[model samples]
Every structure is written in structure tokens, then in C-alpha cells.
Target: MLKRIISGLVGFILLLTIVIKGGMALSISVLLLSLLGLYEFNSAVSKNGIKYVSIISYTFPFLLFLMFNIRGLGLNIQIILFIYILSILSILVLKKDLLLNDISVTLFSLLYIPFLLFHITLLDGNKLIWLVFITAFGTDTFAYFTGILFGKRKLCPELSPKKTIEGSIGGILGSLLLSLLFLKIFNIEHYVQLGILSIICSIMAQIGDLAASKIKRISNIKDYGNIMPGHGGVLDRFDSILFTAPIVYYYITYLL
Candidate 1:
């Protein structure tokens, strides 16, 4: 327990440093991490029997870097998605032996997994970005300890066997408190918006956790890579962020 807390604190400090710097350092960190995420996604897809995983995986980092470098009306993302879609269509047409449904599934997975996660970095320093991750990390931290100590009823028997409904509620409430705490600490002057955002972030974070669990179930593996001792892998560490980021990004940019 102490080890995990210490490791998490160290990791958070390093991340805060990189983020607070907010320049090429931050951009490169995000870019590299996103690339690592893409690699993990591609690795997962390959296990599911997707051909040309290497080519598709490499494309994401290149596309992201290119889009990041471009200056203009910011339609680069749309263009990239369009190009990806067209590429999928072309691949489907070229592979005579592949089923139409299989090709479509592969293409959809390719676009959804890495693309959505990568989109979050574009939001950068928005409150939405911080809200999602902080709430997620908060929820996960609360849920684990709470569930282990006090949980009696299992939430899901298959995907995440140990999680409890009570623990989940505890997580949400814990996330809410943490969100308010952050607002107070930062003097951000946006309480209502932050509360709503906290709810969204907490929900998405749970969803991301479940999503990662589902992936592990599919792969029949325990833990993604175990690089973070108690935390698991990079994917495991950031899964909540993966789901929360897109939601927060959209809400902050379009709705809130």
C-alpha cells in the first residue's frame, strides 16, 4: 500500500512537472505517450488477428504528429479521419479473402481506439482535460481500497469480479469531493461547471476501467504489462483517461 502510494505520488509529480511546463516538453510528452498508447492498441488488435497491424499502428503517430504541426483552420483532424476511412475502404476492397463484416470491424476498431484517445491531447490545458483525469484517478483510488475493505456484494461477476456496487458509489462520491477540492485549491471560480464535469469524468473513468477489464478478458491475460507494480501497465494506468478525455474534451469545447 505504501509502495503504491509512493509510486503514484512520484509519477504524479513527474507528470505535473511536464504538464505545468506547457510547451515543447509537454507536447512531446503527450505525443510520445499517445504513440505508446497507439502501440498498445495495435498490439491488442494484432492479438485479435488483424493483418497489417504494424502499418496501421505506425500511421497513427505519423498522422498525429503531422496534424499537430499543421497550422490553419484545424481541419487536419477531419482530414486524417477521412483518410483513415478511405484507407479502410481501400483495404477492404483489396482483400478479396476477407469478409466484409470482418474488414469493417477491423477498420472501425482501428479508428476508434487510438483516434479517440489521441484527440484528448488536442484539448491540452482546458479544465476538461484536468477534470477527467483527476476525477478518474480519484475514483479508481477510492474504489480499490473501499471495495477491498468494505465491499460485500459483487458488481460484475465476469469482467471485474471484485468490484462492488457500494464501492462504485463510493468512488463516484469520492470523485465528486475531490473535484470540489481541486476547484477550491486552484481557485478556478467555476464550481457548478466543475461539479457536472466531475460527474461525467467519474462515469467515464469507470467505463474506461471496465473497458480495459473487458480487453483483458478477451485476451485472457491478467494485467496489461505490470510496469507500475500495483497499477499494472501504461494502458491500465491511463484507461480511465482514455474514456474520460474525449467526453471532457467534447463537453468543454461544444456543450460546457
Candidate 2:
């Protein structure tokens, strides 16, 4: 418990620093996080002992390039897909021992993990970005403690035994509190819309966590890695962010 609190506070402070001072600081932090997340994701898929070294190696640069070149006739998007195809081809040449199924899994994993996550940070508005962060991590925090205290019905016994319906409710309510607090703190426009977005983010965050748990359960592994002490791995930490950021980004841009 103490470890979780300390880590959470330290992480929040680091994030606040990045957001408070935007530009290179913010971009670099996001870039580093994206790369680390890719690494963790590669690790998750590598549990099968498949030779995916090339695919994982190319993930960071491909995601970063895709992020910066998001415009211009959708060429960037096409190029990202091209790279994935090349990665699949490379596996045939470079890792001759790897079979078709292994290469296919690696391709799917890259497409979903780093490639999908890269877009979330590109969205406008620091407040919206911060909302993604809060929604992702805040929901997890609430769910953890709530489950510890009041969880009764198991949300998914096979994937995550501790998760419960009670805890999920707490997660959503906690996200609402954080969302309202940030809106009030930053004085952003559209209070009602932001609240509704927060609800969406909270639900998506839980789904993200559960999604990662399913991946872990399928892989038959414990924590993705011990990168964050009590927090498991980079994937474990950013699972919610991976799914929630994209949703929030889409919402802020398209809907509200």
C-alpha cells in the first residue's frame, strides 16, 4: 500500500511537471513513454518464445514517425501499414525459424499496441491529454482500493480475481471526481460535455485493464514486468491509457 501511494504520487508529480511545461519536455516524455510501452507490449507477446525481435525493434520509430506525420494525404498512415507489412516479410527472411502464426501474432500485436497508442498524444489541448491520464490511472487506483475494501462480485475470476463490480463502480465514480476536479481547476469550457467524456473514459479505462489482463491470462504470465515495483510493467501501468487516450482524443476532436 505504501509503495503504491509513493509511486502514484511520484508519477503524478512527474506528469504534472511535463504538462505544466509543454513543448519539448512534454513531447519527449510522451515519446519515451510510447517507446517503453512498445517494449512492454513486445515482452507480453514474446512470452511464446517467438522470434519477434525485428518487429519489436521497428515499433518505436514507426509509431513516432506516424505521430509526427499524421497529415499529408494520409501517406503517414499508409506508410505505417507498409512498415508492418515489411515487418511481416522481414520475419520470413530474418527469422527463418519463426512460423507463419508467430509472424501473424507479432504483426497484430504491433498494430494494436504502439501503432494505436501513438495517436492519443497527438490530440490538441493539454487538459484533454491530462484527462486521458487521469481517467486511465485514476480509475485503476480507485478500482484497486475499492476492490480491497468493498469488492464482492468478481468481475472476471479467470483473468483477474480481485476485480469486482463494486470496484468498477468506484472506479467510475472516482474518475468522475477527478474529471470534475480538473475541469474546475483548469476552468475549461463545456463542463457537462467534459463530465460525460470522463464517464466514457472511466469505462474505457476499466476495459483497457481487463483487456490487458486477458492478454496476460492468455500468455500465462504474472506481471508484464517488474518495471514499476508494485505497478507491474509499463504495459500494466499504461494499459488504461492505451485504450482511454485514443477514445478521449477521438471524442475531443470529433464529438466535443
Candidate 3:
């Protein structure tokens, strides 16, 4: 418990610092996290000794970041994806040891980690980007204590036994609290949109956590990795964020 609290605090502080620093700092931090996340995911899924196109998998992330930022290499997004698809397919054909299962998992890793997380950089303003973490982390914090105090029914016993219905409500309420606070600070009046977004994100956050757990269950592992002492790995810690980032990004993009 002590380790959990300490790690959470340290991680939160580091996150707040980078978020405040925005721009290249935020982009690079998230990029590094995506790489680490991919590494952790590959490590987890390969427990059965499945061989993935590791070199290609690692290279694409760097290539993606470069394409987005380096103006000279302004290749079309479709072109980039086309090249990536062919690269992996070529490796699959050449390597008899590699199966479609490995290729599928590799594709999943890219979409799940770097691709989804890249949206954080897409958000136009500081508070908008902050919305992603605020909803995710706030819901998480409130849900933890709320569950301890009033939890009685299991939310998802098969995926995560500790979660309860009470905790789930508390999580949504937590997200609302943080999101409302955001509105107040920014002096915005779009109450309905933000409220709906907060609730949706909270539910999605829980789903994201369960989704990661589902993967771990299939792999027959207790945790993704022991990198965070109490939290497992980048995937474990950012699972909710992974699901929420895209939601927040699109909400701000088209709805608002």
C-alpha cells in the first residue's frame, strides 16, 4: 500500500510537470512512454515464445513521430500506413517461423499504444489535453476510496474482482468533479458537453483497465511488469488514459 501511494504520487507529479511544460516536452514524454509501452506489451504477449516483427514494430513509432513533426518528410498518412502494412507483411512472408498470430498482435500493439496515445499531442489547448488525465486519474482516485468505504457488489469479477458498482459511480462522480473544475477555471459554459464527456470517459477508463486485465489473463501473467512497483507497467498505469485520450480528442475536435 505504501509503495502504491508513493509511486502514484511520484508519477502524478512527473506527469503534471510535463503537462505544464507542454509543446516539445509533452510530445517527447508521451513518445517515450509509447515506446516503453510497446516494449512492455511485446514482452507480455511473447511469453509463449511468439516471434514478432520487432525491428519493424520499433522503427514505425520513431518514423511516425518524425513524419508528424519533420515538415520535410510530410508524407501522406495513407502512404505511411501503406508502407507499414507492406513492411510487416513482407517480414511475415519471408520468415517461416513467424505466423499471422504474431503479425496480428504486432498490429494491435501499434494501434493500442502509440496510435491512440498520439492524440494527446493533437489536442489544441492545455486544458483540453489535461482533460484526458484529469478524467482518468481523478476517476481512479475517487473510485479507490469509494470502493473501500461503500463497495458491496463486484463490478467485473472475472476481469477485476476488486472493482464494485459503488466504486464505478464514484469514479464517474470523480471525473465530473475534475471536469467541472476545469470548466470553472476556464470560464466555459458548455456544461452539458463536458458532463457527458466526463461520464463517458469514466466508463471507458474502467473498460480500458479491464481490457488490459483481459490480455494479462490470456497470457497467464499476474501483472504486465514490475516496473512500477505497485502499478505493473506503462500499459497498466496508462491503460485508462489510452482509452480516454481518443475520446477527449474527438470530443474536442468535432463536438465542441
Candidate 4:
């Protein structure tokens, strides 16, 4: 318990620093996270005795990191993905050992970890960027305390036994409070819009947690990795952010 709290605080400090640094620093941090996350994902899959094109999974993010850091790189996604898919298929054709499931898992890993996580960079580090963390952390922290205080019914026994319906609602309330407070502090308008956004984001955060939990259940593991002592891995810690980042990004981009 002590270790978890300490680690969480340390991580928050580092995250604040990165967010403040913004620009290239944030980009590089996200890239490195994607790389490490891919490693963890590939390892988890391999534990199930499944094979995949691990190199390509690693390579694309590295290239993306390059593209992000370097201006005028001229490397487009269509071309990169075209060649990547072709390479994976060619390997599948040539290598009797590699199967379709191999490539499928590989592709899924890329999308799940790096692709979704990239939205943090796409967030572009403005006042709104803080909303992603607020939604994720607010829901998580409040759900935990709320569940402890007033949890009676189970939410999803199959995936997470401790999560209760009451707790889920608590999560939303927590997020709403935080979101409104942020609006107050930032002097941002649109109270109704932010309220709705908080609800949607809170639900997304829980979904993201369940998604990661589902993968862990399938992988037959308790935690994803021991990278963060009590917190498990990068995925364990940031799973909610993975879902919320994109939602916030697209919502602010198109809807708001």
C-alpha cells in the first residue's frame, strides 16, 4: 500500500513535468511509452504460446517517433502501413511457422497500444489536455473510495469482481465534480457541455479499464507487469487514458 501511493505520486510528478514540457518532450515520452507497452503486450501474448511480427510492431512506433521529432520527414502513414502489411503477409507466406493469428495479434498490438496512445500527442498540450487526466484519474480515485464505502452489488463479476454498480456511478460523480472545478479554475464556459463530456469520459475510462482487465484475464495473469510495483505496468496505469485521450481528442476536434 505504501509503495503504491509513493509510486503513484512519483508518476504524477513526472507526468506533470512532461505535460509542462510539452512539444517534443511529450511526443518522445509517448513514443517511449508505446515502445515499452508493445514489449509488454508482445510478451503477454507470447505467454499464451502465440507468435507475432514483433519487430514491425516495434519499428512503426520508432518511425513515428522520428516523424514526430523531425520536421519534414515526408513519411506518410498510408505508405508505411502498406509496406508493413505487405511485409507481414510475405513473411506469413514464406514462413511455415508463422500463422495468420500471428499477424492478427501483431496488428492488434499496434493499434491497441501505440495508435490509441498517440492521441496524447494529438492533444497538443493545451488547457484542455488536462481534462484527459482529470477524467481518468477522477473516475479511478472516486470509484475506488466509493466502492469501498458503499459498494454492495457487483458491476462485472466476470472481469473485475470488486467493481460495483454503485462504484461506477461514483466514478462518474467524481469526474463531473473535477470537470466542473476545472472549468471554474480555467474560467472556461459551457457548463452543460463539460458536464456531458465528463459523463461520457467517465464511462470510457471504466471501459478502458475493463478492456485491459479482459486481456489480463485471457492471458491468465494477475497484473500486466511488475514495472510499477503495485500498479503493474504502463498499460495497467494508463489504460483509462488510452481510451479517454482519443475520446477527448476527437470530441474536442469534431464535436466541441
lDDT tens digits, residues 174-223, model 2? 99999999888988888898889888989988888888899888778887
How do the residues 1-256 of candidate 1 rate in per-residue lDDT, one tens digit apiece?
A: 7877877888899878876666566667766766666566556655666554355545765666656665663647778777776776777788786566555655555554566666656776665456766788899988888898889898887999999987888888889999899888888876888788788788778988898889778867777666677776778788888777777777777765
Compared with the true structure, model 4 gives a TM-score of 0.96
Q: Which prediction has the highest TM-score against the true structure?
A: 4
- Where does candidate 2 have its weakest 10-residue lDDT segment? 66-75
TM-score of each: 0.87, 0.88, 0.95, 0.96
What value of lDDT does candidate 3 attain over all alpha carbons? 0.86
Instruction: Compute the lDDT of residue 224 as modeled in candidate 1.
Output: 69
User: Model 4: how far is 174 from its true place, Å?
Assistant: 0.6
What local distance difference test score does each model get? 0.73, 0.76, 0.86, 0.88
Q: Specify the highest-lDDT model's number.
A: 4
Clashes of each: 0, 0, 0, 0
Candidate 3 local lDDT, 1-256, one digit each (tens): 9999899889889988888877788778878988899888888888867676678778766766776677698765577778888988999999888899999888888888888887787773557788899899988889999999999999999988899999999999999998999989888778889889999999999899899999888878888777787988898899999999999989977899
- lDDT for model 1, please: 0.73
Query: What TM-score does prediction 3 earn?
Result: 0.95
lDDT of 4 by residue, 45-90 (tens): 8888789688778998877776666658887666667878898888
Itemize residue pairs with steric clashes in candidate 2. Answer: none
Cα-based lDDT at residue 30, candidate 4: 95
